[model samples]
Target chain A: MKTVSLAEMKTGQSGRVKKIYGGRGMVARLQALGLYPGKEVTKLSAFFQKGPVVVEIDRSRVAMGYGRASRIFVEVGE
Target chain B: MKMSPKPKRMVLAGNPNVGKSVLFSQLTGARVVISNYPGTTVEFTRGKLQAKGQAWEVLDAPGTYSLEPTCRAEEVAANLVNSADVVVNVIDATNLERNLYLTSQLLERGVPLVIVLNLIDEAAQKGVKLNVPRLQELLGVPVIPTVAISGRGLPELVAALPKAGRGRGEARSPDERWIWIGSVVKQVQRVTRRRRTWLEALELASIQPLTGIPIAALGLYLVFKVIIGCGQWLEGLLENYFFEPFYLPLLQSLSRFLGDGSFWHGLLIGNLPGGQIHLEESMGLLSTGIYAVFGIVLPYLVMFYLVLGFLEDCGYLPRLAVMSDRMMHRLGLHGFAVIPTLLGFGCNVPAVLAARNLESRRERLIVSAMLAVAVPCAAQMSMIIGLVGRRGGAYLGVIIAMLFLIWVAIGLFLDRVLPGYTPSMIVEIPPYRWPSLKAQAQKLGMRLQHFLTEALPFIFGGILLINLLHLVGVIDLLAGAFAPVFRSLLGLPKEAVSTLLVGFLRKDVAVAMLIPLGLTAKQFVVGATVLATYFPCAAAFAVLVKELGVKDMAFVAGIMLTVSTAAGTALNLLLDTVLPAPMLALFLLGLAVVLIAFCGGSSDRRESRKFTLTKERRV
Candidate 1:
């Protein structure tokens, strides 16, 4: 498994959340919304550079901007 | 059973888009918006259920992921759960792990609870199955599995309602709670991993830039076309059949009965030249008052709500929210704030009410200000189109473009200067489903009923008050006092002052009142601009007061006065020879450059975050 920023992941690629690299407040918020270590999240769509990225996790689609997505580290299983 | 103890106050609690509303409607027989998008309710809704010889009060609060209360809507949800006797916690069966976080919070509240595992149909399709009996035994609550829209398992849900148990809410660490949830899910849930379904594929294609942008544009264009086309067709029918024949003759007869030029006649029928009642110009309670509300505004109000209701019920709104996130970021708002902005064009009252979906008090203030100051509702727009479109489309374009710039500018200013931070949006967009026709019609009818019963009184009462003031010569005195400002500042004649005053009551009527002014194209542009920017209608004003409280309303009022005066005067001076549209557009472009340069104050966001953190610490 190779870990990369969620922002760097291509659309349709699936990964398990490995680490969140952000402020305490933002990290807590993302965690409350179901993005935590070991949970699988698949990228639905990532628009142009710096735009919001859409991801699907456990049957819900969540939208996160690049700034926040970059701080989230995800491991894609090979 | 001692009258069943007033049937127990049952509040349906859940993360947004988990079918709380659908279940609420099924239980209470009250239709509500069931869009898969989060925050469609924005505020809680109450309905009564009479079954099993007990009267039960059912509430459907705005959806929240957890009990921590991030935004105003979540705060509402969290606060509501505190007062309920039995909380019906709706868990999405397919996503049990994520949804259980909120269920765990509800359990900790020590309330008697009924666990509703909703959307079972969708869950089954996704290859997920739950052992409901085992789940119930573990959670120590009565569990009911339901497919809300289809009414599956609803009878069993009612049968199990009386078995709710009050939890001890034993205080435990969040880690322990998570572990407990994981254990429960592992024991009760079976997940079969499978390939993507067609619905999932559609959801994927909806957010990509290349496809999503064009789809959004096409969808929005269709929505507007249907509203405008249906509204105009209804307007034509009302004018020919109802107004010209029935309402007009009755008004003219009332004019003759009171006798033209008499005080009673003038008060009731207004100043009708040649003793004929002019519905639009008469400015009386029975004349323009009823005419404006029922004839002009009602059709557009109905059509807009109907189309909007369909869009909202089918879950198109969240997709729109996703596509607009980048633009919303530049304006310093969460992407979800776009719903209220879209509703603003339909009507400002519901739009202001919808602003509560935003996270902070600062955001609520900014959204309301944006609506009252810049956006024109569809009713107001129709009249503006009727009057302004006659001159040339360019004049009307200038007004709209100017308002859009003001909206962005004010957002930038408030986002910087306000002493709080907007939470970053993490909107949960559910998969789209076909809307039910009966539910859509019921929702649309309910909103239309609200408009007529609530808004018409204010419109008629305002026109009546204006008529009384005019009869008493109070309007003349005020208009005389403000005539200089009205003439030089706004480039309008003094008589137009009354129209501007009536603007505060209803902008639709305000624009209609401008018809008798006979002003130049430039002056009409200035007058309409000031009318829109100065203040919202009486109905919108009351809603803002309720939503923002009196103190914030006063602050918003002060800003409205200052900024509207500046915008109106600026337009008047600039529209001397050439069109002011291009010049104002250029100026706004420069302002955008400056706003982008500073990023609308990065330091301010950090400072506000600190302030909010301190407040939270104190709490």
Candidate 2:
């Protein structure tokens, strides 16, 4: 079991949400969009290192900025 | 019958990227800006609706992920929900799990709700379906499945307005609401996964870097070719048939009636260079004014929206926002900033309005200045292309390079000075689908109408003002006043002073006016670039004021004047001696790439490493 921030995921990789940054409020905000712990999110494309990463979660695509995306810890591999 | 002065108010609320704006436009028969991407509608748009013997004033509230506000716009949305009499909660059928989170919040507020399950067509295509009646029963509100973009189920949604009711359950905590929504979705909705289609594959390909960049280049090239080809074809037809047979005769008759060569005739028909009437080139309200709007620019405006509508409806825009994100970050905005910049290519009026989607005041200022200074609207771009394209593609290329360099420079400077904001992109990219024809036509009609009502007046009014200035001899005085700067700074002729001044009113007309000055190719390119970037048109000016406020607009104006003047002067003095246009384009593009890589490349890795170290310590 390997863990990496979403920002570090290569294009076409898949991972499940392991942890999110900040407190209950931040985690709640991420949960509202289905990015809670254990949700499977596939990295569709990670725009360079400084850009937002595009990921597909529960069949919906979302883009998160570098600062936020880097904070979203993910468990890689099925 | 005493008509109550107070109208029944209903606010349409939804999560971002749902079709609330489409539903708003369909019911009210008024157009609102709709983008496939989230956060497109930043402000409330009000329209009146008459249905079911009750007149309701509908407010389209900005989209929110939840009632709990995360950003400034969402705070406005939360307030709207509290004040609204009845809230029409629009939900995306395809993403029920995500959308119902907001619906549950609305339901908890005790506001009467009518759930419009929008984009049901897309949901169906994806093999997802909702039992509308069952959902209505569970939520204790009327649920109507709607294909909003095409106006389908709108009548049913309207009729269900009277059936709006509070849900069976009381308010709960955020965690409880999520669990409750999950149960509701499971009970009433069905999702059956299907094999991927070619469209789905193509959508994926567009996001991946190996394929998307080439596709974007080809797509943009095609868009430009179509706009130019269509505009020129229409221009030739109108000039040959309408101008030669109809418009010229009418102007000639007016010349006789108003006493030809009189002050009135001169004001109405312009100087008529050698007593010849040319519709496209004439400086008159009756001749060139009508010609420029209807003949020269109108065709391309139609084509651009057609292309734009397709791109938006098919959900390619947010993907573009994703792809352009890194580049935009280097320019000091989130990738979503490209959305407004792209819109600026159509017309800066709406583009300025769209800048509201940016996250912060500083972001708004940057995008507005970028649009006004670096990007030329379709009408302005068309004129530049028509004039410069004849000289050489490279000549056009040089002007673009100069503008691009200035655009990057201004962005870098602003990103440094303007502190306290630069939120990273966090966009929801909708899956691509085929655009609906009926919806596309309706959307196109709305944009064209907006352009006509909002922009045409400014163009016509500008010509009238310029004509009055000419009649009063103010033109000569001002031209003389500005000649030294025009000549020494931009290396353009004295007559170009008036041409550039007219840019304040209408840029396309200003560029077209340059043709009569008989400037060389270098002067023409330099003059056109300066006019395009110097200031926004009157229509765009009004919008920038409303969107950014007076203080911010003044700041933006300062930036525009300084950057445009400096760029124009530099281009005039150094362009010929510099590498030819093609090489210059390549050189500037390479320089931009290198600069961005240097600035964004090294600093970010260090910042992220430090960020992670701090997080590790905290953990």
Write candidate 1's Cα lDDT for B411-507 as tens digits.
8877777765665567777777778787777777777777678667767766777778777898899889999998888889898888777787778
Instruction: Give residue A64's lDDT in candidate 2 (0 to 100).
Output: 74
Off by over 4 Å in 2: A10-13, A23-29, A48-51, B1-6, B150-152, B168-171, B253-260, B577-580, B599-610
Residue B168's lDDT within candidate 2 is 53
Q: Where does model 1 exceed 4 Å of error?
A: A21-25, B5-7, B30-34, B108-110, B166-172, B191-199, B419-421, B549-552, B580-619
What is the interface RMSD, in angstroms, for predicted model 1? 2.7
Deviation (Å) of B544 in candidate 2:
2.6
Q: What is the lDDT of residue B599 in candidate 2?
A: 60
Using Cα atoms, each model's DockQ against the true complex is: 0.53, 0.65
Q: Name every residue pair that clashes in candidate 1.
A: none
**DockQ for candidate 2, C-alpha atoms:** 0.65
In order, the B-chain TM-scores come to 0.89, 0.92
lDDT for model 1 comes to 0.79
User: In model 2 chain B, where is the ten-residue run with the lowest total lDDT?
Assistant: B599-608
